[model samples]
Target: MPVFFRKIISPSLSPNTESDDVWEAVRAFLKPRSWQRGSAIDEIEHWFKDYYDASAAVSFDSGRSALYAILEAFGIGLGDDVLVQAFTCVAVPNSIRWAGATPVYVDIDKRFNIDPKDLEKKITKQSKAIIVQHTFGIPAAMDAILTIARKHNLIVIEDCAHSLGATYHNRTVGSLGDAAFFSFGRDKVLSSVWGGMAIISQKSPPKADQPMAEKVKSPPAGEAGQKLRQIQEKLPYPSRIWIVQQLFHPIAFAVILPLYNLIIGKVILECLKRLGLLSKPVNDQELRGEKPLFMPRRYPNALARLLMRQLVKLKRYTIKRRRTVAYYQEVFQSRNEIIMPKSIPGGVYLRFPILVQNQEEVMMRAKRAGILLGNWYTSVIDPVQVNRENVGYIAGSCPKAEIYARHIINLPTLISEDEARRVVAMV
Candidate 1:
């Protein structure tokens, strides 16, 4: 086997030159407004409704922020309990806490998403909401979750941060819940540097639950507007080459990321630099506020402009991801040692996460083969950790999630057909 991980087939924008034109338009609009306009923000919001057919979208600084906003919007706080998947990223429970609510860790099924059965068991009078996450772009049992939510009249907050273009039974993931949150980070389905969005419910959003005016604002258009235009004017150049290099250069990445973190680790220097506290670390004290400090850094202004231009290409990427996932399912079906993800009719595969046994051993093997596998959530770090529940969200509780978390290895599905086959062989 080669000592290099197979490269992902990029489904990003074409002409890579259009980013220039898009940025030019952005620049022209922001000059008179002194970068105070929200049109760029509106473009992102409209994309949800126009492209994904979402009801309404509110842009935020990050996916985590959107998650917190949704919880606050639902009036989930102080002694209230929100059921969350123990297998999801820390951001899930952290959002629950941000709302001044406690998060009850629930087990997950083989799909790596919250188990509907487990969800039903965890509900109580204090329960005010359920945070449904579509783990690894794989849609959870939305029908079952919706049924349970309806029976209990519980608020549903779909974490579409990982399932952007993904749908469950023809309906978009965000629309399935009472409200939804999406991530538009560098690694997400859609890239907008470091921004995120909150998709409000199709019905009425719970006004009593929304953030207080003290914390809410019209949401500034920010500096992104001005920079977007400047980048557009320079788009005709070959900028994607850098993108390709990063995706393909394993050695450079290993060296570069560590160096970047080292420079950022200096608290004194960062503070002196006037790095805003909000920009420094995630605030974990808020129970519906920020917790578990890990936020993706904002992409360079140039990159954001590039992403804006390339947003349309997401459709093609979605198709390739879906097809690649199908191929893996077919080939891996006969392997009893692994549990493959189920098909979600028309959804795109943001990532292809599979369950297995002896994950450490599997990971070691894959690593030796130059396959860089991702451990979506290594531990359930929230609600319990913060609540001082020393018992923590144990492994055996959600056997399926634990199995996937431990033994499951995520293979790249956003690769060319040939690359997909090679990855399967490595598995």
Candidate 2:
């Protein structure tokens, strides 16, 4: 029998740091002059460049856009192949396609990062670059990966979306690769609702042909929606779960969950947009067909302001997250059933992911206990129901990634100690 959760104790519901400070910044910047054409964006880019020791840093509307820009800047398009891990967000591959390049799927190792050995095997004559994702803030084997990239003369682009503060052998992740991109999406280590940064370690490329900017010129709907969702989290857990549960069919769990996100959730988001709320909810569908590949857009002034405020407290947040990971490590060390990855040196723990049999049952049990378990990368290409052919992922090519995708579940690091204990007990 499956255990069903009545209450939700979600890490996704964790409060942002220095909320009062952030709100104050938001209030002060209410006027158009405050955000529009201000120095905040420049300040943020410099901050990231200095923090990561990069030669330059550029901000964008989203991480995917940042990556697309990198590929475009490097002239990696049509007939070029970019190597990427199979166990990752669809956005990773989508960025490649957006740049008119093909994404070659590679397998992941135990740390949920690209396997250098497998990476070397997939490099064909058309391979132009490698996007090494530091999965879940766990750094990949940079030494091995860099070696492989150097051997093949491929440009290395680090996907630092999951690893803002993470380091590899005393070096920050963004600085290790030739170029790297970081996301400031709602659930990332640092959240500004929706923003991204691209850092360059080498010489900049000549500007590419720019696409005419799309004219959806109202205030960013995605930012407004993120604020509304943050307010929604303040509601009691039961109420939150009830509201989400209402959107899905009663038999949702039995069917593929991403399907619900694609069909029903898309409608709800459109309704929210019509209501004058700019809610750009995350979609689970794979990128297909030819789309206009445009140069990365500038970061919004408002989001840059919010991100600046959050940056002040980033060190504290990193410390707290590491402490939470330590707690989980101590508690779960002896458990035979739960398989936690070995600790990576200089790694900043994001969600504490573990491999287990009967992952669905475990997640259900956790939810019933009011624990909000993370369901990250539940498939090799993530949100697995998407058309594999569209993204160039062969279903049976990466056997290990397929297996890990089936068994991996993540414990939230944003919960309280007591809640963490309860989660451990329940699981």
Candidate 3:
């Protein structure tokens, strides 16, 4: 018999969601006036501007949309090549493609970040920028990457989808690069079910403790300000129906999470999905490198309200994530079968990545044990379902990413050490 689903650790669901957040979503769905339109958009923008130490923070429908806007803002297109590492989400590459720029693949190092050496090797005259992903909340080697980027006069766009509240060398991940984008997707560091933002750091942002009145009302001057306004104007406002559908996520899971076994909960979840209520984190068109029809829109105000609630708990979440990684490191220190990532200061450690033999078997066992061991970057691109050629990922290009994909299983960080021990023993 299939095992009962006791818990899920994957970033996709809101295991970290509080009861209040679900209740808030319920309120928003029922009260259209609360979510139909509001000032939450500007408030969230100010919050990101403050958080990322950026001159401007622009909201978008998804992280990819933010990235796309950043690319567009910089006028990267056609023959331009944006250097990006392998073993990342398809959304990263999709954004580049959406802007008509090619994503030149680079390999990752022991830290699961872009190898500066390979990054330099792949650079060409067409290389306009380097998209450095803080892979799984672990900061990439920004010192080396920035040096390389400067040497070539390339813009550095930090992909902070997994690295919110994560830091490197005392600087936040998003602030390290020329620009950065964040995901508030169900699976990201924070969850509003579906949201994202872009932070352009061309100029020094307002002071760390800048007043909100000064921050939101005052956008950066000159080119940066113009770019942000341009992107915002081009974006379509999110559909009200879509907004409610995403809001339904937390509500559905509030009940579903408690009853989700291999039987009943699974059936209800599938039924709701078939009914087009719960949106998949990744769309099918994205796997094939095609843009979703509903994309390139501005993030909704209602969802921003949800994100605001999460922002209030950012510090608490960061501590838990880092502590969980430390716990994993301590346990794996004596183990010989699994290879732990190198320890680095300031890394938030979104998911503790480990390489092991028989990755499939390990995950299968974890599933049966009622522990949902996350499989991030299951393929060089992600989800193991993407069309490699369509996504521009050539076979045998990044061998490390491929090997890591075969063996990597990410342990959850939001869990307690006692629960982590249960997860660790399964490995």
Winner on lDDT (2 vs 3): 3
| All models, RMSD in angstroms | 9.9, 11.1, 5.8
- Rank order (by TM-score, best first): 3, 2, 1
Residue-level lDDT of model 2, residues 258-334, one tens digit each, is 22224553465456446644423245333342343332455666667767777887787778778878888898899
Cα lDDT of all candidates, in order? 0.59, 0.69, 0.83
Per-model TM-score versus the true fold? 0.70, 0.79, 0.93
Among all windows of ten consecutive residues in candidate 1, which has the lowest summed lDDT? 8-17
Model 2: weakest 10-residue lDDT segment is 245-254
lDDT of 3 by residue, 60-81 (tens): 8889899998888777789888
- lDDT (Cα) of model 1: 0.59
Q: Which of 1 and 3 is the better model by lDDT?
A: 3
Of candidate 3, the 10-residue stretch with the lowest lDDT total is 213-222
Model 3 misplaced regions, further than 4 Å: 1-5, 34-36, 202-222
The best candidate by TM-score is 3
Rank the candidate models, highest lDDT first. Answer: 3, 2, 1
Report how far off residue 386 is in candidate 1 (Å).
Answer: 11
lDDT of 1 by residue, 1-40 (tens): 2343233222221111223434543453334332222345
Clashes of 3: 1
